[model samples]
Target: MSDFIGDWYALLVLLLAGFLPNEVWRMLGLWLGGGVDEESELLVWVRAVATAILAGVIAQILVLPPGALASIPPSLRYGAVAVGLMVFIVAKRSILAGVICGELVMLIGKWWLG
Candidate 1:
């Protein structure tokens, strides 16, 4: 849109704000990972930190969702996740099967409950 094109400085700032953290982390990972062994303490710490951050984000989403998922009950949300995991494990980690099974479960739940 013309408005967006006219606001090029704002767009540039937004782009940099979004990209810089990921770029910094990627570059740092490349720098540190080049010489480091997989079992190194720093690598382990980084992995643990990343896992914790991801878990926190997932927890927040589950506990306090926004958008369409917010309309679904927490129990159903967790149930879908559990069912998806079971399907994934049973199907030897087939991503498609897991996704389809989870979506099917949600659809069924919505139809039956709503």
Candidate 2:
């Protein structure tokens, strides 16, 4: 009984410690940004910057992959990204489709090459 209570107590503490703080900021952002126009110049610039940052991160991962990803070969990595992008466009910009397709291509390429 004590062990059960201790386990739940630890879980509650962990949840509060990790989740509540992030949620507070997210809720605050939602409230503050409620009046912002999506088509405004500021939002457009923010979107572009976010996209650029995401592209940079992806490029870094492909060019200088870490751990097991490094063993997959650059050609496969590039091919995955290309195929993923194509699928993303073809699937009406579905992020899930693109990500899954890219991951599948990478895994299949690695398996076949080895």
Question: Highest TM-score: which candidate?
Answer: 1
Residue-level lDDT tens digits of model 2 in 1-114: 886567776889878998897799679779887687769998799889989999999899899999988888899999998999999999999999999999999999999998
Scored by CA lDDT, what does every candidate get? 0.87, 0.90
Give every collision pair in model 1.
none
- TM per model? 0.78, 0.60
Find the number of clashing residue pairs for candidate 1: 0
Regions more than 4 Å wrong, model 2: 1-39
lDDT of 1 by residue, 18-112 (tens): 88878998798788776768798987998899999999998899889989999998888888878998999999999999989988998899889
Query: Residue 95 of model 2: what lDDT?
Result: 94
Candidate 1 global CA lDDT score: 0.87
What's model 2's lDDT at 92?
A: 100
